[model samples]
Target: MGSLAPDSMVRRVYRCMCGINPGLEAPTASAKTGAFAASGVSREQLVIFLADTLRGTAEERAPLIMAMSQCGTEAAAAVTCEQVAEFLRDLISTVIQIVVHRGRLQGWQPERMGDGSLGVKLLAEQMCSELKPSDQGFCDVSSLEDFIFRVSQISLYLEMLVAEGLNVSLSGRPTPTLLPPCRETPWKELRCLLDLPTIMFLAPQLPDRYSAPWRLVFSTQLHGESFTRMVAGLSKRGPTLLLLKDTKGHVFGGFASHAWEVKPQFQGDSRCFLFSVLPRLRVYTATGYNQHFMYLNQNQQTMPNGLGMGGQHSYFGLWLDNDFGRGHSRARPKCTTYGSPQLSGDEDFTLDSMEVWAVGKPPEPEEGEEGEGKRSILDVDPEVQAMMEMAGKTLHSQGLREPEEEQEQ
Candidate 1:
């Protein structure tokens, strides 16, 4: 019958009403009320709740706007306007942050600032009115168009907001220059200009009078279905030829060969073939193949011996000659050649000559393989030949020669 403590009395009152021990309950209501009080919502909450309810009932923007405008009490309008102004300020700040980040505009330059013209002053006025700052007042200026345009380039939403505030019509046309100047040029463009496609196209052609001792180094790593498809494609495009350089014993020699092989089993409806190399892992092609190989061998570093009927050699030549000796060449079985040589257990050997062949001619017809009136596989295509001639002329005008032309003695 003794009087209960304040906490126990509150619990007893709660339990009596809800038929549950209030002592076991979480302080959810108290926490919510505390937050609401901290935010000074005691007077504004009812007004906001009523305004929200009225807003929900309205089907169109006209009714909602009219209701807000016609609110009876000054306190209601003030609260609602304050909330709207805060929302607009937050939205504007977020948009500005996004624009700055995407445009990569870190520091401001005074030179780039637009003078406070009539258009800019008007925009500032609208922004200030919407944000309702106490100390800072909005101004009107003529440079608003430039500001709106720059921000628009970064974010369409920001553009729309600015347009709405300025009461201007927006066209869908894209203005690339309107973007901040930071993204005008990208690093990738320079890289693409120097890529393989550009280099091959720009390379000079070998002169008809010059017969250079040249070797093609086609270094590649293609295998499985992809290799077969590429080989087949290359074969159909033109004659398939394999230039093999073998060094070492016949059983365990280094074999590097390039061929356009065909694979009929590809799933795609279009016939797919590829240009491939045997011992498929060690083949590459490019404009710099021969020069790179020669440089490596001359330096006595381990490299591929890519000399085609010439004196070019790889770093691995010495080791192969010593350990594997010379093996029969695929092109000329009578001529023994050393394949790619390597230093025994040397990891410093670099394969700089590994690249795809930029240019290749068809092979001459063998003596017994000729058919009546059939052109040899080695016969040059008239179109291809003409293109090569044109390319050579262009290169001559540019004072450059094909890599093969440079090797001519």
Candidate 2:
């Protein structure tokens, strides 16, 4: 999509491919595209010619080109006929629907975008002759551009997926549950604008341990108490991401490198950082900031009944109240305050929304760390575990797990 820079397209595609098959090798175009050979054009020539048309300083295009090259290399190494077909089928279907939905370009009317999207309008007209866009007699130029761009880049990605594979179809490969889409909001759209260098710098800073797929597990507004419970239950298992939206529409959050604790002392490593979403994505590290109170805690004295963060007092970071909408705010200068944008104590004191995400899988066991025993579901406090067991039996007696656990049994 034109909304996405060239580098973003390459990264998303590459990331998706890697998620689909982490071990996939890089790829190059195969000789089987006989049409090119028949036309006396080799892949190298086509690429060089395309490169000539790309307008930018060498430095500007280098990373994007490098990403594209990497995608091709991976595609060439482990592509299969089935994988290519599946990828293409899904891409075409998705691109078409996405284009038809957005249907806007540079705020221009359909009659003005020229012949690029004429086919799109004609098809829409067939479905509903009175539709606003169809009535305008103009196709959406913006959506069309997105369509073409996505198609071209994704096609290249698909080709990479099946670069040198034999044509064959097997029926038994288990399909994975698609990763849930990231939260869609104004803040997220801003995050997409980060450039390659910034992204590279932030990559390792992410609390997530995995490089490829990350899924959304909780949104305060959507999940309510379940959200708090899930965090309290699982935060210690891995890193967690917190995103908060203030009353003024400012979006920012922190990463907790260690499991959250309700204790009064600051916790977590330097890997913990704070970042802002709107205006632009800028990350602030804990290197020189106050480190004593950049921690997550939960207790009654906490301004709100739920979860809150700060150095010692509830002066910095976000505070998500238990009742959902009432007690939330991001204020003052703490670990991320020195050079970062300061939130107004008055305007941002009450937040609009809050979200939390569990980052990456639990860390793998490292050398000599195997002796440390992790707290498991059964290891919860004796009284709590006993209560849970009683509740489990009660639910079972009521047949709550009848059909649900039957399949597993």
Candidate 3:
């Protein structure tokens, strides 16, 4: 070629760099990576390019974060892990100063401070590949120091930002709207941005909806007595069904076969009750993160129906009075027969005893409800009961039998 045109030269270089025929469409990143490695664009060059692109501008950074958080592709993770680390290290320092100086010094509530701090913490964790115990310790030290120093520098600039509500509040205020009334912030919007899936997986009962549920059953071994105790404890709280299988190992494998009707009480005050059972529970309420349930009893008093109803306070009080010996008691009978007596000493009883606890003596057994009556699985419409019995038997035959073999028999 005597003198290649500018366009021809560019095309040739692109084709050579990507190992694609000039006439063919562009190769994918995988193909390009393989080709470039052969032609001498080292892995380091690709990483550097990715890092530069991630740091380009707000327009650029938003797309990169969205891609890294949402896309389930290996390439996205590889690119994100490499780039987010450096970005996070820088972001952490800035966040620390903002939270410590602007929030603490200005008399912001701990919840508000925590919200800002958690955002920084989450960002830092996301940037790192694995957050181990050691990394957590390091983060604690760094974050504490950052908080303290920032608190010392509460200035006019910080006050303006607070007035404008451009910070995250611990009480689950959305980002960029720190101290605004809860109703004004975009709590649901930020949750959507976080891109946490609607489900999660853990052997016991799935990972409480934060981690996506893995459909496969996981086996955990338990001692016969311990397993029985666990089942009994769970049954007292709700209807529990379990399976114990011999996996041929030293450990006797166990799985939850079926749980009877533990419905999520999404209405009224019951939402808080459901969240109390999990290690970590995050709900996207209309205002922001529903932090009310996290430390309800510790930080604030329990609202009438056991919810932090915020401002919608109801005056009427209802108490469950269980007194078998005393005449004319107002207590409602505990629904289940299992361990109703044991609940009298539960911790939650102290704050909202009216809902779940008995105020006085146990309820007297009515004439018809005297014996150890068993609710027949048969009583549940024939189709449903048959299906459940079939499932229970199938599980039992598969080596996962209930401790009391009579149920299966």
In terms of TM-score, the best-performing candidate is 2
Per-residue lDDT of candidate 2, residues 324-361 (tens digit)? 45443444443343244453234335665565665656
List TM-scores for all candidates, in order.
Answer: 0.18, 0.41, 0.21
* Model 2 whole-model lDDT (C-alpha atoms): 0.41
* Candidate 1 lDDT: 0.25
All models: lDDT? 0.25, 0.41, 0.25
Q: lDDT by residue for model 3 over 245-295, one digit each (tens)?
A: 111111011112122111212122212212110112222112322322111
lDDT of 1 by residue, 1-409 (tens): 0121223222222221221112422111112211222333232333332232222222211122222222222211122333333333333333333334345232222123222122222222333333332233321111222223332221343333233322344466442121112111223311111121111111212221112112222222221223222233333222112222222211111212233222211111111111112222121222222321111111123433222221133222212221112322221211112223222122222221122221233355567764334642223355754676777743232234222223247
Q: How close is each model in CA RMSD to the real structure?
A: 28.6, 17.4, 23.8
Best by the lDDT measure? 2
Order the candidates by TM-score, highest first — what do you get?
A: 2, 3, 1
Instruction: TM-score for candidate 3, please give it.
Output: 0.21
